[model samples]
Target: MKTAISIPDDLFVTAENTAKKLGIPRSQLFAKALEEFIQNHSKEKITEKLNEVYSNDTTKKDNSLSDVSVAILRNSLKNESW
Candidate 1:
């Protein structure tokens, strides 16, 4: 697949240099980077969805530890006389 990408000149220079150092064409370097980026972000999206589901399920029950907020902890500390 042929696509046009508008990359910043500095970044392009660095990428080109890296490709040269690795003895690979600049196109291959870009393809590998795109593949890795897609895989990583896909996993991140799945993890985010799982976290959302876990949070929703826990909300229906008494899960004090997971539900505690930073504000609540700060207020508790402030109210303490010691």
Candidate 2:
């Protein structure tokens, strides 16, 4: 697929330089960048949906662990450095 879009000259020059440095065509660079951008926003959308669902649910109980469980977890992690 072919498309045309306008961007700032400085941005265009930087992208061109980056493409050359990476030994890929300008189209490939733009395509890869756009693909990553779309994927990242897709993840963000999923996170937003999950947050909305959890926020609207009033029946959700506290997720705190029992004292014994917390003690076990803390003991397990004690061997590891922060």
Instruction: Tell me the spans in candidate 1 whose CA falls farther than 4 Å from its real position.
Output: 58-82
Model 2 per-residue lDDT tens digits across residues 1-82? 9999999999999999999999999999999999999999999999999999888845434333465678899999999997
Instruction: Estimate, for each residue in 1-82, the C-alpha lDDT of model 1 and write its tens digit.
Output: 8999898999999999999999999999999999999999999999999999877865545556545665678778996887
Cα lDDT of model 1 overall? 0.89
After the best TM-score superposition of candidate 1, give how far the Cα of residue 48 lies from its true spot, in angstroms.
Answer: 0.6
Clashes of 1: 0
Q: Cα deviation in Å at residue 7, candidate 2? A: 0.5
Task: Tell me the whole-model lDDT of each prediction, alpha carbons only.
Answer: 0.89, 0.91
